[model samples]
Target: MTRPIAGWLSDMDGVLVHENQALPGAAEFIRALRDHGRPFLILTNNSIYTPRDLRARLSATGLDVPEDAIWTSALATAQFLTDQEPGGSAYVIGEAGLTTALDEAGYTLTAAEPDFVVLGETRTYSFEAITQAIRLIQGGARFIATNPDVTGPSADGDLPATGAVAAMITAATRREPYFVGKPNPMMIRSALNRIDAHSETTVMVGDRMDTDVVSGIEAGLRTFLVLTGSTRREDIARFPFRPSEIVDSIADLVDRVGTPA
Candidate 1:
C-alpha cells in the first residue's frame, strides 16, 4: 500500500501554467490543496522574480498562489549561501530577484574581494557583467549560480540563462559554479525543510524529468511527471530513473490528493 500524500510541491511552469495561461486543471488542483488544508508550494527554477512578483504574475494568469507559497531558485541560492557562510559578501550579477533575496539573507553585495561571485537569471545579461564576474572568480571568489538551466524560452526564441553565462565564467576562470536550483536535490531538501514535511508523505509534481523528477527522487519524495511541459511520455525511456507516477497534467491528480497512490 502506498503512503498517503500529506504535502505537495509542484513546478510552476509546465505543470501549472505555461507562458501566461494556466494549464488545464491546474487551478483546480491548487484549489483542492487549499480546500483540504494541505501544505503545498509552487517551485520555479527562474531566479529573475521574487515570490511576491511571482504571485502577482500567477494572479494575472488566473492562478491564485499565495506569495509565501512560491519558492524560487534565488531564494534557494541565498539560503544555501547562508548555510555555507553566514553574513558572507558576494559579487552579484542579476536583477532585483537575486539581489533582494541575498540582501534579506544578510549577504552584502560587493565587488572587491567578495566571498562569492553569484550568478542568476536576468532578462538582459550584460557582457560587462560577465566580464566582471570572470575577473572576480579569477580573483579568488568562489562561483555560485542560482540554477543550471542553460537556456530559457522566450516569445522570440531561446535565450541564454544563468547556466550558459556560468559556463562562460568557468571557461575563463576555470572554476565551475555550484548550482543551487532544481536537479541539485539540495533545493528540494531546503523546500521540504521549510515546510516541515517528511519526504515519505510528500509528493513532488513536475513537468521535467531531468530537473524536477530527478531532484524529487533523490530527496526521497514520491515523484510525479506531467506531460504538459518540456517532457513527453516517450522521453521517459531516455532517462535512467523514472517518476513514481505519471499523469497527463495537474488536472488528473486533483481527486487523488487526499488518497494514497
Candidate 2:
C-alpha cells in the first residue's frame, strides 16, 4: 500500500474559491480536513488581506475556515525576513497583512535607512509609496516583494499586481526585487513547518502548474492539480513538469482526504 497523506497545503483562489465564490466541493473538502483532524493550510499569494480578514471572507462564502488555517504571502515574507534579519526595519508598501506580519515578527516599519523595502498587494497602488520604494532601493535598501504574480483577477478584469509594480520600481532603481512567494518553494516549506508536516507525507493542491505544482515538487511534496481553477488539462503539455495527480476539482479530492493509500 502507498503512504497516506497526513497533511495538506492548498492554494486559495483557484482551489477553494473563484472571484469570491466557493468552488465546487471546496466547503466539503475543508470540512473533511477539519473533521478528520488533518493538518492543512489554505495558501494564497495575495498579500492584501490578513488571515482574520480571509477567514471572514471565506465565512461569507459559507466555508468554515479558521484564521490560522489560512496562510498568506505576507506571512511567508515576514517569516523570511525574521529568519534573514531578525527585528530588522523595513520601508513597506502594502496593506495590514504585510505590516501586521512584520510587526508580529518584531520588525519595525520605518522609512529611515531601513533594512529592506518590502512590497505587497494593496487595493490601491500609491505613486508616492512607489517613489519612496524606488528611492530606498537606490539608497541601498534591499528590495523584496511578497509574490511575482504580474496580474490579479478582478470582477472587471486583470488588475496589475505586485510583479507589475515591482517591474516599474526595478526600471527606476535598476534592482530586481526578490519575490518570496510561490515558485520559490520557501513559502511551501514554511507552511509545512507551521503545521509540523513532513514533506514525504504531505500533499500540495493547487490550480496552476507554474506556481503550485512547481513549488510543491521543489518542496518535495506530492502535488495535485485541479481543473476547477487555472491550468486546464490541455495546458499541462506546455509545462516541463507535471503534477502527481490531476483531478476535475476539489470535489474529487474530498473523499481522498485521510484515506490510507
Candidate 3:
C-alpha cells in the first residue's frame, strides 16, 4: 500500500453526508483520523452556507466538525471577489449564504448597475432574474461564479446547482465566468494555507473525478476517490480523470491507511 497521508482534505456532500444525514462510517472515520492526530479539513463546493453555519448544521446532525475545519465555495468566492474588486458593488444571483459572505467580506451587493455579476445556486431562480443578469453582463458587469457544480443532492433528488445558473449566463452573455470553487487551484490553495499543509504531504478525498480528482492533481496532492457519492464502479471506465486511490467510502479510508488507531 502507499504511505499514509500526513494531512487530508475532504469533500462533504457526497463523501460524508447526503441531505443533512451523515453517511455510514463517516463519523467513525473522522474520529479515527482525529484520534490519530491527523490534520484534515472539509472542502465543499456548496456555497449555500458559511463555515460556522455549516458547522452548526453538521453538529446538529452529529458530525462534530469544527467551524474552522469547514471550507465552502462561498468563503472562497467571497475572498476572490474581495481580492479582485475590493468593496465593489455586485449583482448577486444566489441564496442568503452567498449574500452574507459577500457582506462579511465588505462587498456591496446590489440589484442595479452593479460592477460585477456573481452567480450561485438559487432555488428561486426566475426568468426575470436571468434576463436581468444577462443584461448586466452585457452592460459591462464582470461575470463570476462560486463553482461549476451542475447539480447538488437534495432530499427529493438532484437539483440544479450554481453551475447551471453559471452556464445559462455564459450562454446568454457569451462570456466565461471567473470560478472560485473546487477544481480550481484557488480553493485548494486556500485550504492548504489555512492548515499549513504541504502539497506533497496532503491527500484530497472526494467522490467526483472531474472536480475533486482534477483539483487534487492540479494542486499537486494525492487524490482519493470514494464511491459513496457521484462516481460509481461502472462509471470508472468512462471517467477521463483518475485518482491516486479509490475506496468504497470514507469508512474504508482508515483501512487503506493501515491498522486503525
Off by over 4 Å in 1: none
- Residue by residue across 1-261, what tens digits does model 1's lDDT show? 678899999999999999889999988988888888888989999999999999999999888889889889999999999999999999999988999999999999999899999999998888998999898888899999999999999999999998998998899999999999999999899899888888999989999999999999999999999999999999999999999989998999999875655
Cα error, residue 240 of model 1, in Å, equals: 0.8
Stretches > 4 Å off in candidate 2: none
The best candidate in terms of lDDT? 2
Question: Candidate 3's residue-wise lDDT over 1-261, tens digit each?
Answer: 455477889999889887778988888877776777777899888777778888888887789888888888888888888887898999988887788889999988887789899887777888888899899999999998989988877679889888887888889889999898988988998888778888888889989888898899999988989998978978878877678879888888865444522
By summed lDDT, the worst window of 10 consecutive residues in model 1 runs over 252-261
Global lDDT of model 1? 0.93
State the lDDT of candidate 2 residue by residue for 1-261, as single tens digits. 446899999999889998889999999999999999999999999999999999999999999999999999999999999999998999999999999999999999999999999999987999999999998899999999999999988889999999999999999999999999998899999999999999999999999999999999999999999998878899999998999999999999999885835
lDDT of each: 0.93, 0.94, 0.84
Q: Which pairs of residues collide in model 2?
A: none
TM-score of 3: 0.89
As for candidate 1, its clashing pairs are none
